[model samples]
Target: MDLNALDDFQLVAAHGGFGRASRASGRSKATLSRRVTELEEALGVRLVERGARSLQLTEAGQQLLARTEGPMYEVADAIAAVREGVATPRGNLRIAAPSLFGQLALGTLVARFRTLYPDVEIEVVADDRRVNLVEEQFDIAIRIDPDPDTALVGRCFARDRLVLAAPPLLAPPSGDLDEVVPVPAVVMPSYREGDIWTLRDRAPRLLPRPVLRLSSLLMVRDAIVAGAGVGLVPQSIIGGQLQRGELVSWGTRGGDVALWVLHTSRRLQSPKVRAFVEFLCDQYPDKAFLASV
Candidate 1:
């Protein structure tokens, strides 16, 4: 409520007159008088008695000054706190991420974050299972969908494309996942053990090589690199191995999923969380592991 007028009246009382308040506050006496007059008019009460020489506060002004001084100082403190939080990102940031990303690229991401914000501490949990971010107190979670939980705040930064990868020793002449089905092979972090890896965005009859499922994507990749078999896996995790000649992708017909960076409602506002999310958006704008590494 007309805080400028309240402050002007307070200044007038504190320094004894508009002339003295003008000198103290560096505001012109006319401006100070105008603010005080507006305050009194807004309040529907005369807060001060104007005099030729002596200036005196009325009961209303005295009561307001008594009641509002503490609250105004609190407002100032709150504003200062928000400003400081915006300027600096310093805190413990806990993250939950997909096991494959953790094994393949999270190390580099964490290192980059450390270099950029040395004061922030990073803690990460890598698991295929999606955790309750709020219950676990994680600042962020990474997911590849079709996930059921649609409640979190998130941004999709990259696509997790399925690559039909195999080591050169076991490379199929046909260059098709279905053609390699007779060979024993693998992908981990699977929901079920089956030969039917469905191809979407295309004909339902198309399928990947029947995967001999392992427990983790890393194990599946390692088995493939060691010449075990061809299996469908995310391209983000296998880009390095493909480049290094340890593994080669047959290339898939479909089965690409969007990678999301999800965060809790409360931590979404934090400077550290916002900074990391924005950095992820910039760093990944594509498949991050393939793009960066």
Candidate 2:
């Protein structure tokens, strides 16, 4: 199979059609179409369904693109590095992060990164879904308490602990250490009835009466701030509110959860990836935003 033809086919599929691919690559539409045809002939499979007004990839084309896109970009990066003597952070860097974390922290960090490396382009996808980094072509992923994956390697950038917090007016009065207080609570969808919250070792337990169920932690925090009810929220996210006296922390909940900056476990780390990981570590030098209270 012709590698150049395969590359051209990928370019066309990625850009949706021959004309757009041609415009993006500075190659004529006729040449791109011919290359794709040659690739299909060599592979003995139809890759694209070309139409007058629209273009669609066959199932085979979609599979091939999914399997090869990440490797293709890696190969391109390798070649570019060899040609340039030193690999500088100058290409697109795609990042995947949790929605709340992205909204709370990424804006400032990303802005600082762009100022330092003006040549690199960034795209951040903020979704809570656990993504397959290699298959999805994400350069980096910021995850909280990620499961063990041999295909990935990363460093823990920061650690956070959950705190049962509430507006000062709604917070239950401090009582006996062993007492279980039933408080109206804003809870996550995962919270269940009769579930007792052990905020900390030797600390009083909370029997939360679910007043509101929210889909995201951000929503739960907002509800708690508005005097909805007590809620379990991450200290990193709610620290400012607690310090400003907008909310009162009952106590820490569970063990600390580590925030990691992860990438594919490839032998060679791209300069861009290395730079970003280092920047994250620097930002959280203590590996935690706030101490557990």
Candidate 3:
């Protein structure tokens, strides 16, 4: 009935003393003491026993405390919901990604994400090196690695394949991986596993004649698309190209290279980061989109 007094009594009960409650709530001890007394008088029951050592809640106080917690929490949640709705998912979200992944996939993904949620502006720093996400102040990091950083929590959203691919005009897949490796090819950093091409059933030290060595995977893809060379490329980057007959899978698909969304544990609560992670996962479902695209 008396909400203010009821709140004061709850605070006193929680703190175990009027002086403690007053200090915590920034109210005078006299005010808190008076509020609880008024609450007891209004309820026609004894709410607390003000003693020398501590204030002990009576049976009535205990009952009221039990019933009031739920209502108080509900009120607090309702206020929070409104505030969150007004402010969340509207600020700039900084992302750190590998250069190749950023150019090919993340660019399109971020475009689509912005189209859906216009308020969230994205800033991406593309580099192949693994930067410290927390030190960089990045909201999330898109990484292609076998194992993500141990300090950060990550979600493996997509398992990308390293595929030997070329433009349809160059040469079609004859189901011969050994024959394909000798072909003049373009090579990027990710495709090289300790100086050997990562293709299925591949022989050791087979990649010898890469025609063009580009630093950027995006450039390598362009060269392959232009029929400049046959090369190993990420399935995630070129799936749609393969589907559209722009590029053909020339040789064997390589081992699964996991793509991770890495972030600090503290950043898990960010609304924009959460929304983007879910959005990215939705794009790359369980089944590969290579055939569908």
Question: TM-scores, in order shown?
Answer: 0.69, 0.68, 0.61
Off by over 4 Å in 2: 1-81, 171-179, 290-293
lDDT score, candidate 3, position 82: 69
lDDT of each: 0.76, 0.87, 0.75
Residue range 198-288, candidate 2, lDDT tens digits: 8675456778899999998889999999999899998877877888999998888889999999999647888788889988788888896
What is the Cα-based lDDT of residue 180 in candidate 1?
29
lDDT of 1 by residue, 27-141 (tens): 9999999999998888899988889987988888789889988887787789898899777888899999987778777889989998999989999999878788888889899
Candidate 1 vs candidate 3: the TM-score winner is: 1
The numbered model that scores best in lDDT is: 2
**True lDDT of residue 108, candidate 3:** 80
lDDT score, candidate 1, position 210: 44
What C-alpha lDDT, on a 0 to 100 scale, does residue 272 get in candidate 3?
82
Ranking by TM-score: 1, 2, 3
Model 1 Cα shift for residue 278 (angstroms): 1.7
